[model samples]
Target: MRAPLKLYLAGPDVFLPNAAAQAEAKCRLCAEFGMTGIAPFNPDLDMARPAAQLWQEIYADDLRMMRESDAILANLTPFRGASADAGTLVELGWFLGQGKPVFGYSNSAVSFAARSRAQPDDALPGTAIEDFGLADNLMIEGSLTLPLTLPPDGQCRPFDSLEIFQLCLEGIAGWGQGFNR
Candidate 1:
């Protein structure tokens, strides 16, 4: 039997209060879809260490996980800002750089342009937002050829919702023997 594909889970969910729970749930879904999910957290890492040293270790550790995975499943859901989490983008880019398969899902079906409302403290006021009809940035969707995965009702789901996440895994499973998993 073919081995299961190892998928690197990327997103800002690592910063969430329920991070471990979220990762466990995702891992369970991955197993059902015939793949292995590797979340970003490392329980062995000492959190009480110096801030700078700990952060560096985290960066190295996550990269190590990505190196071991066969593909990446990124949560493109927007966090505090308008676009997807910056850290997730970095992980996606890392997978893309290695020519590995990259898949993504977002809870928000709204275009990034629509979400890019100008605020008084905006860094670049009057800057035209790109409206290419994409869930996030052009570079992201342009490379992945991924359409926004939304619920059957075509409505936005919550950040932690796994409805679309399963859809993404199904899409990956639909790839069949291509993954050799």
Candidate 2:
């Protein structure tokens, strides 16, 4: 049997519980496809550490996993805006900077300002799609591709939402195999 492909999942650990479920489903899908999957699971206790130390640990672990993986799957769901989790965005940049293939998923069918409860003091007052683009930066340079894995409108289903997960997995597997050549 062919070896499993290694996937690196990126998302917000602070606010997105759905990210964890997505990661798990992706891992399971990878296994089904005979590919290895790697995802970071930051528990509440991990968040209890000092901010600086916690960041240090998180970055280190994420970096290690990215370095060891073949590709990345990122959740571009906005935490505070129409883009993605800040940490998730940062890691997406890193992965792209490394020239790795990137796949992004998001429910950004709406504008950023529309999603915000209140404008930040530093808010630029612009659209989220314009700020973040339709896809992650790296994916544009032939390194990534943004595919819609969720409905454009309405609430997104949970990670245990098997149908969506399977769809995502199938896409990833196809992508991985395409790049494997």
Number of the top TM-score candidate: 1
Q: Candidate 2: where are CA atoms >4 Å away?
A: 13-25, 42-49, 111-122, 125-143, 146-148, 152-165
Report residue 160 deviation for candidate 2 (angstroms): 7.9
Give the Å error, residue 179, model 2.
2.6
Per-residue alpha-carbon lDDT of candidate 2 for residues 1-181, written as tens digits (9 for 90 to 100): 4456677766663354576776666677768876677887655338788998998897787788888887777666556553467777677777778877777665444444454524463656553422343332323324456465654355665433445445566787776666652
Q: TM per model?
A: 0.94, 0.68
- Which pairs of residues clash in candidate 2, taking residues 3 or more apart in a chain or in different chains? 4-34, 4-35, 4-36, 5-35, 139-144
* Number of residue pairs clashing in candidate 1, backbone atoms closer than 3 angstroms, sequence gap of 3 or more or interchain: 1
Q: What does the lDDT come to for candidate 1?
A: 0.85
